[model samples]
Target: MAEALQPGDPAAIGPFRLTARLGAGGMGQVFLGESASGRRVAVKQVRPEIARDPGFRKRFRREVDLAMKAGGFWTAPVVAADPDAESPWVASQYVPGPALDEHIAAQGPMDEAAVRRLGAGLAEALDSFHRIGLVHRDLKPSNILLLDDGPRVIDFGISKAMEDGGGSALTSTGMVVGTPGFMSPEQALGAAVGPASDIFSLASVLVFAATGEPPFGHGASHALLFRVVHAPPRLDGVPPGLVTTLDKCLSKASEGRPSAHEVGAMLTETAAPAAGRPAAEVDAGGIPFDVRAPSPAPESAPTAPNPRAAGAPAQGTYIAPARRVPPPPPAVAPRIPVTPSAVHEFAVQDGGPAVFRRRIRKSALWTALITAVLCTSTALIGQLLAGVFLSVIAILVGFLPRLVGALPLLVRSSLRIDARVLQMRLGGTAFTVTWQDVALVSVSRTGNTLRLVVVLHSDAKRPVPAPLRRPGADDDREAEFLLISWNDQAVTSRAARLHATLAAAAGPAYRPPVRG
Candidate 1:
C-alpha cells in the first residue's frame, strides 16, 4: 500500500500531481503521481542535496537516457523527466505489483515454476539493457516488480552507459555504488563492470526468489561484499533444475557465465510446466494446468465381464476370450564394419613408414623463411651482445610458425571413414562421430576460407575434448573444423573430397550442398 503524502511533500512535479509517497531511498523520494491526462506514474524526486551537486545532475540525465532506451515488456518505461527542475525528478510507468523482496516476505518463497519464469523475464530485461549499451549496476530484489504477467525491472538510478566509462567521478576510483548483497565480485572489488556483472546480480536475485534468502545470506555490508567476492553462493534450498544454470551465472569469472540470452534459453528449456499436471505430462509439453478432476473409475477403463456371473455357459462363453498376445518384435540386423579408407598418405623423408598426414603449404614455409632472413639481417647491424640476442629471437620468430603448422603431421592418428564411425586424430586429441549421432555434414565458405560444419543430433552426447573444442564450438548442437588452406587459395578440391568422404560415412544423415 502507498503512503499518503506528508505535509513536507510537494503537491506537484512538473504536470504530474503527487498523490502519495511510494517510498524513499538514499537518492530520493518516490511518489505516486497522476498526470494531467489522468495516467498514473511513479515519480522519483531526487534529494535536494543530490540535486544540488553537478555530478549528480549529469548522472541523473544519463539515467533518464538509459531508462528511455530500455522500453520493453519487462522494464518500466520512462514516461517523463525534469533534470532542469529545482529538484530533479524522473517518472516511469507505474507497475502494479509489489517489489520482489516485499512479495517474497509477504508470501513464502516462490515455487520452481515461478522462479524460472522470473529468471527468464529478468534475463530478457538484462538483454535489453545490454543491447542499448547500458548496464544495470544495481540490480536487486527491490528493483524487480513481481507483476501478474511477469517481472518488471525498475530503477536505473545506478545504471551507466557502457561507453560513458561505467560511472561518474563520484563513483570512480574506490567508491563502490551497488547494494552489498547483490554486487558481483568485480563490482565488490571496484573493478570494471560490463553486462556480465548484471548477469551475476540476476542470478543472486533468482536465488532470493527461490529460497527467500540471498545467495550469500545476510551479513554486514563489508562481510557480504567479501563473501560475494570469495565465497560460494549458499544455494541449499534452490531447486536442483535451476541450480546448474544459476551456478554458471554466478561463476567467479565473468567469461564463464552465460550471456543473458543464453540464460533465458536455458531457463525456458528447463522450466517446469504449470501446476495440476503430472510431471511426465509437463515434460512432454502436454496440457498445462490440467485442473479437471480425474475421470470416474467406470469411464477410465472398460468393464471386463465378471468371472462369478451366474449361468455362465462355458469357460469361453461369458468370460471374455483370452487376449491375443502380441507377436515378438522383428530382429534387428547387426551393424557391419567397413575397412577404413586411406585416401591420402605422406611419409617422413627420414626413416618413418608411409602415413596419411596433412602437410604445411609451401607458401607458408616460404613466408616463414623470408621473415627469418629479414630478422637475421636486422640483428647483424645491431650491437654485438644485442645482435646475438636478436638473432635468437629472429630464429624463433621464423621457426615457430613452420613448427606449429607441421606439428599435426607428427601425431600418431588416422582419419578413417567406415560404416560405424568417422574417426580422426590430430595430436593427442581424438574425435569419433557415430552415424547415429550425425545430423548433417556440409562444407561452407566464408570469404576465402572453407569450413566443414558437422551438426550433431540434439539428443546426441559426444563430448568434445578440450583441445578439439573451437572458440565457440562448445555449443552442444554443432562442431566446426577449419579446412586446410594454401596462402590465400581456396581449398575447394580438398574440401570437396573431404565432404564426399564424410557424406559417404554419414549415410542418410549427410546433407549435400544445393547447386547454385
Candidate 2:
C-alpha cells in the first residue's frame, strides 16, 4: 500500500521522519513515518490547497481531537499531530496490512469466517466512533485496512466533522459525503446519518469482502446513488449463511438496519451455525467477552455530532454482560392474511411482506361484556327504570375506547407495508402513509407498551392512523401514529424483524428506535 517518497515530500514532520508515500486521498497525502524512539506511524498532512481554508482547518483540528478520543481498539488511534501547523498533519499507529479494496483486488473474496471477522472488527470500530458521537460518513473499502489482528477504520474526521458543524464544506453539488455503491439511503438523500447508517455501509463492506463487488454494482456516481436510494440490494452471490443477516443490514431505512453491536453479534455468533441453520437466528448478547474495554454510556439522541458536547466518558470498570439466549417461541404459525384493502396496494411490493395481526377479539369482547353486565345488573335489580336507562348510557360511554379497538379485531386487523406506502388497519381505523410524506419512523413509549410509530411531515394529511394515543397527541392521532405495540409478542412474534422491516420499507424515514 506504499511507494517510495516522491520529490517535494517532506523528509521530517515534527519528531517523525517520512519514509515512503502511503497514498493520497480526499483529505491529503499520507506518508509512512517513524518516531525518534522507533515507533512506525502513518502520517497524513492536509493538502496545501485545502489546508488554507478556515473551515477545513477547523475540521482538521476536530479530527485530531476525535482520533485522540477514539483510543485504539479496532481503530488506529492518533499518536502525534500539529493541527495548528502551516500544513496541519496528524499521525496514527501505522497498520501494516493493505486496504480492504486493494486486498480484494490483489487476492479474491475472503472466506465466510474471514468476512465474519472483518464485520466484527469493523462493528467494534464503528461502535467506538458512535459512542464518541461521531458518524464515519465516509465508510468505503478504501477507508478500512486489513490487519492480521482485525480491520482498522480510518478517515473518521473530515466529512462527518463538516456535518457536525452544520454544513457540507467537504462536498459540493448538493451531495453528501460518502462513497457511491456503499452509502446508506439517508446519506444518499443528505438526511440525518446515524449509527444505523454506518451499519448499512458495514453490510455493503461485508458483501464486498465476500463477493468481490459491492451489493450495488459500481459505475457512475449518479447511477449508484439512485440505485442506493430506490433499489433493493443485489445479494445474488452472497453466502447463504450470511444472506439473511446482510439483508437486514442493507435496509434502506437507518432504523431498519441492526445496530453495529447487533451486527457484530450476528456475524460473530459461533454456535457453528449447524448445517442448514438460519443465519438470522443469532444471540443478541453475543458481544465478545475477551476483548475488554469500557462500555460507553448510552447515547441520549441519534443525530449529527458536535465535538464540544459529545459527552466525556464517565470513569468505571466495565465488564461484558452475561449472554442470555432468548428461548425459541413455543409455536411458529404462518402469518395471518392482511386485510384486502391493504393487501392490494402492497401486492406489487417485493416478496416477504410483513403482516402484524393477532387474535384479541375474545379478550376485548369479554372485558366489554363484563363491564356492561355489572353495570346493568345493579341498576335493573333495583327496579329504577330511569337509573337503568342512565346506567345503559353510561355503559355506552365507558365502552367507547374498547368498542373502537374491538371493531378492527372483529373484522380483519393487521399492519402491512410496501416500498411506497405503510397501510395499517387498527382499532377500527384504516389509513395509509407514503414514504415521501414520512418525516421519520421511530419507536416510542406509550403507557407500559413500546409503540412502533410513524412521525409525519408537518403538512402530511391528518388525522394520522395510530392504534392508540401517544402523550403529545392529546387524543388527536396527528402527532406520531402508532402502528403496533412492539412489546406484545401476541401482536407479532418477530419484534426485531418487524422493526427492521418497517425501517426498510420506510427508507429514509427510519430513525433509531429510541422510545421517547
lDDT of each: 0.68, 0.64
Candidate 2 contains a number of clashing pairs equal to 0
Residue pairs in clash, model 2? none
Candidate 1, residues 453-473, lDDT tens digits: the string is 677788887765565555687
In TM-score terms, candidate 1 sits at 0.53
Instruction: Provide the TM-score for each candidate, comma-separated.
Output: 0.53, 0.52
Residues 1-516 of candidate 2 have per-residue lDDT tens digits of 789988888999878999999887667888899998889998888878667766777766776787688875678888888978998888889887679987666555655555776788788888778877777777889989865445788765454642474655555434456787888888877776778888889999988888777887654464466568766777766768889999999987677788877887887765253234233222233433222222222364222222223454232211211112222334632122222332222111111113212324444465567656666776677755755565566556655554464443344445666656777665466777776787767765444244666666777766564443456665443433343342444334234435545544555466655445
Quote the lDDT for 345 in model 2.
27
For candidate 2, give the lDDT.
Answer: 0.64
In order of listing, the candidates' clash counts read 0, 0
